[model samples]
Target: MNQHFIRNIEVKKVRHHKNFSIHIDDTYPKHVIFTGKNGSGKTSLLEGVKSFLELFDQYSIPALSEWRDMVRYNEKSLNEADPSNVYLTDQFRNQITFFSDQIDQFCKKVELDIKNAHEIHHLLEEGKFLIAYFNATRTSSMLTPNGVEKVSLTKKYPIQRGAGDVFIKYLVDLKTQAMFARQEGDLDTANRLDEWFSYIEYNLKYIFENDDLTLHFDYKNYNFLILEPNKEPYDLTRLSSGFSSIFSILAELIMRMESSRTNLYDVEGIVIIDEIEAHLHVSLQKKIFKFLTDFFPKVQFIISTHSPFVLSSVNDAIIYDLYEKESYEDFSNYSYEAIVEDFLGVDQYSSIVKDNLTEYENLINKSSSLTQEEEEKVQKISTYLDNAPDAHSNELKLKKSYIDLKRILREDTI
Candidate 1:
């Protein structure tokens, strides 16, 4: 496959911006991560890219009518006769031109043109160059049986409404495909399906370290079951939120990769995941990127995350911290603390704990002797630190800080 990357993208009057430009290809990382506070236009930027890709696939340009309706409100230019006219002369117009030229260049580079539209369509149908988008507002409610009903491959899959529905359907489809393959004496295809299932099981076990729990598919009922080491198997509905979330994401990704005739380790395509850290623990967030990179080495993952753990885990990814605008910042070498404070705009430790520590320090500085109130506050902080969960490495540093503060208090008393 020809190497294709979005060289640059510029937008104006899109949402909250007069002009915004991002040059991705110039500092091309293996993957890209979007991080920002809420209402920071991260999702808008992702949607813009998605729109461009879809329009390019259809050989269509951004229509002026669509822009007029979609463009950001011109609050400053209310006096203008037509606010939409401003878009035609500003960065929005330039962005349209840029997208058009880039799409043409990319098509030529990939040997896709008007004459090869049929070929492009075939490739897209086969899931080649797939652009998978996972919306943030996914629900983890029970996967209804109707959601897993056999879908015709001849038709496009329905847009997933529930969080786990798409994954459940994919799992059911795989089982169906495997059974059909076996009946047709296609052992290789059946075996591949089995292999994929085993891969999922292996990774789940590795991550969870629950040797007793194993993933099982019930061919009889077309349902997924979780089998304990010695206990009776349970339905997927009984699984924990974390397990369900992880399994759903991994299953969907594996299915997409397989559709393109790519193995777990060799899948190549673009995957856009909004709120990638949703429902994931810090430990899982740290491992998720590593696992994804190992599983889908060639895949271009564009993710929007709010977790410092996720940002810190990835070293070779381009991190775009979108606040007022989007800009590529190399966060591969940044420490977790730096990532939290600088990119995430927050302290590494809890604000409550930091405040207590600051107050304790202030009291200690004001007088050489420790008062009853100051001593009680220090003791309270020390107790809090002692009781705090050490799920993260930063917690250890916090614990040390508490110890040092106690030691200083002791010295002051002496």
Candidate 2:
């Protein structure tokens, strides 16, 4: 297994960040999660890392330079007083040297002029590296029936619409090729397709926990189908948003690992996910970290999230809480409420309720007889607590005490 790690990252005058540095390696957790308020440069940092990785390849250096120029210019003042600066340190740059040999070897392969030849070669080329970036907005459409047949015959890979949709299109294309092979008595090619499909199915079932749901390649319509245990088959397009998000990411990862011929245990690469908790329910968010860690133990996952539930999901993860400066806080043992209050800057209890409780306490502790205004204030506080949203058990018990105090005050006044 080829291990790749960014020992440290330094960025200056990029996006909303001025100067920032992050350290990541074996000494730290393999999985790192970034949490911050919106516009705190979380996505910017991810993009910076992506660009840095691209620089490792000779073929991609020019593109990275061009991108830097564009970002620098756009971020500069009208007079161009400040320039955009972004680059990896020599230490981190040296780490990516290990992948260069594999990348060069893959790019040197002889070109094959066959149907879908470009797509196959492209997939193979990408397989040389394990690095992938998953965009938050993913598409779910598959190629139309006529379009699939045309591409299958022409052997041309279609332009990708989105990561998820493109992956499904690849599966459909492979299935079509298998059909063609079967008609021509090419059983070997057909058998290879079957094996790939079975691998995908097994992984999906194992990771997704949908034992009754089976994946099917709809060659006739050129769509992906999911057959439920006791329900009718449905198009992959109709899957729930949360399921679609997770499935698309998993499918892409599995496909990349398979294409690169990387073993499950030896797969080492960086995966950047923006808004990792988007569209996921609380239950799924809590379980997602464990699943990903167990599934890809060697892969380094960098994720940005806003969910407290997601924050509390992992104990060993390196957490970067971005504010004015990056703070590495230990939240491993913090409760959900503590995480929300301290890290997220949100109080577990409502301020209105707290204020009312305070007023009720002060009134009860009075040494002199209650005035008309104080009596009226207590009545309003009681009314407010009665209508307020459900609170903690301790708070509820306190409310009961306030009610008893109100009864005593009324009887004393009478």
Candidate 3:
């Protein structure tokens, strides 16, 4: 199937990223996983990507033509934004041309002559292209517009579209209708509604690891239930935080796909999973990459994660480290711990322990005998470890090192 994915992306001067780029090719899998520290621009990259796509999808042709001149940067805002390495208002316009060219190429690749804003809008209205962006903020409340919410095709989704609630509401409505039809002895109408929803039920069930698990919506309680073959049913929250997270994510993805007149196997577009491991267990973190890929075979997945456990399934996947500005196509020989400590340059020890160990080791390597100042510092460390009611393991070890270091200053190991 003809499709589209980000072959390369460059965020020259976007939020918190002065210059960040990732080049993808057909050599690796279409799914890309980005990993970084907390303040290391992982979320910022996702924000930038979403911003660009929103621009491409929404901007008119005249707007694109005049985007560069559409903004005036105030001095105060620019100065404030400079500290965060981002823009005041001009950043979005500056990248309009780049995203325009990308969209042009993407259209050509998909065999669509969507050269201008109207053409893109028309194609999107027909559901020829779609985006399934599951933003990190998943706890957003339901939006029941105009006192009614219905399951229908939509070209775009706001960052906070909680399809999980709407999806349940749709099912509850359908079940209610089916119940009324059955009470009226209209078995055909009731059976037809079940047939219409069979595929979705199968999809929801198959995504779970346990095939015996069955999902049911409790219209009275307004919650979902998970029942197994022999065990008693329970609320989905009892499983794991990650389970409900992915369940909601998949719920939205599938709903969007079906509403677009597409399916998981053939929908062609981009998917953004911001902070993929935010609410996931370590085990679930290890499975999400493959699960997403297998579930949506034709879509390009760009997800961000902060967990090292994600390395468990980086198979044929491009791994980008935004903090280090490094990209790896393969780390098959490295353990997840090694990736965290050595490859990613994260020290396992705390700052105090590492610094004290460094000071002690420096004294050991430099001096054959202890100086007065060195002896005083060692005595201090010993006191800190002794009088402390509860001390860290490394601190206790440092206390022992102080004893031996006082005996001989020529020690270089911690």
Candidate 4:
């Protein structure tokens, strides 16, 4: 079995990040999450990893000049706004030359830290171990590329950014080729193609909790059809944006891995997804990480999301809260409200509820000097708030406020 995952990474001024580093130890879960607000280096971290690994190719470059797009907007002003090649300063030189020296330095460090550079690059090219980053370009449609018939063993290693709709294209090309093989009376070849695609199709059905769902290529209409157990079949285009977002990611990822590795079970490597909860429902957000980790058990998933529901899904997953600069390995016991409050700095309570809670807290502060009737009233309010039905799931946060007042009366402090 071929396996690879990042052990450590360090970078400076790679993108919007001035200094960034991460280390993955053996104790880390197969699934990891990086989460923060917009413009908080989540995307930059993924970009840095992609840049670092792609540089090891030594022969073919990885469109490194795109690093300019990954920088601080004002940093562009640091470059000569010169349209025609005349520029001064290290910043402008870095931009013009695609950060050549920094990339060279980073690649040298990678080669030193993770030796066997030749073997690593070769395995990556063969897709023995995959490393890919996915951003928000998934909703776009895919068109089959010319000359693409069936999966080719020596297919040129693809960089995903060049084609946003790789998954759909993979499906169209493979299924279309299978249909042609069947028409040509090549039963064995057709069956082989179907067999290759069915693994991912079956897993997709499972991930979606749609056991009776079926996928078909509509050659007549040139559409991919989704057939539920009882309903009439519909085009993939009819699916919701949330479905499109997640389905495209899963399809592209597995398809790319399969192009080199025929078995889904043996595929292993890193997959970084930005804004993992993009169009997902709250329930789907909670299940997405667990679903991916469970289905693709060997692959290391490093995902970013703004959803606290995602943060609370898996107990063993590593969550790097970039905004807080904190890492947590166990969070399943945390309440959704507490996760939101502590991780996102979001106040999950309504204004009226917040106002009332604050008032009760202030009243509790007077525990050192409370009249008998006033103390009784404060206790009643606190109890009511504590026992509120909606407060059940929020026991973690509720313990600090209204419930703690009960402790304050006995201990003379809140």
lDDT by residue for model 1 (283-320), tens: 88888877877777666777888887888786677778
Q: Write the per-residue lDDT of candidate 4 for residues 1-414, one digit (tens) a residue.
A: 224555555545644555555555544434668876666777767665666666644432333334434343325655536555344445554564555554464452332123233455667666665656778555635554444444444323444533335555567777877888999999998998899778766876865679888787766555577788778887655667888787666655665566565544456666778888888888788888877776666677778877888888887667887776667787788877777777777777767666667667777666466789878877777766666555565552555455575754668533
lDDT of 2 by residue, 260-306 (tens): 44335345556778777778878788777677767777667878887
The TM-score-based order of candidates, best leading, equals 4, 1, 2, 3
Q: Candidate 1: give the clashing pairs.
A: none
| Each candidate's clash count | 0, 3, 0, 0
RMSD of each: 8.5, 11.4, 11.0, 8.4
lDDT of 1 at 337: 72
Task: Report the Cα lDDT for residue 165, model 3.
Answer: 49
Clashes in candidate 1: how many?
0
Q: In candidate 4, which residue pairs clash? A: none
Which portions of model 1 show Cα errors greater than 4 Å? 26-29, 60-122, 139-151, 154-190, 206-212, 230-232, 237-240, 262-267, 324-335, 367-414
Candidate 2, pairs of clashing residues: 115-155, 116-155, 116-156
Best by TM-score: 4
TM-score of each: 0.67, 0.63, 0.61, 0.69
lDDT of 4 at 254: 61
Candidate 2 segments whose C-alpha is farther than 4 A from its true place: 26-29, 57-126, 139-164, 172-211, 217-222, 229-232, 262-266, 324-332, 350-414
Model 1: per-residue Cα lDDT at residue 410: 76
What value of lDDT does candidate 1 attain over all alpha carbons? 0.61
Best-fitting candidate, scored by lDDT: 4
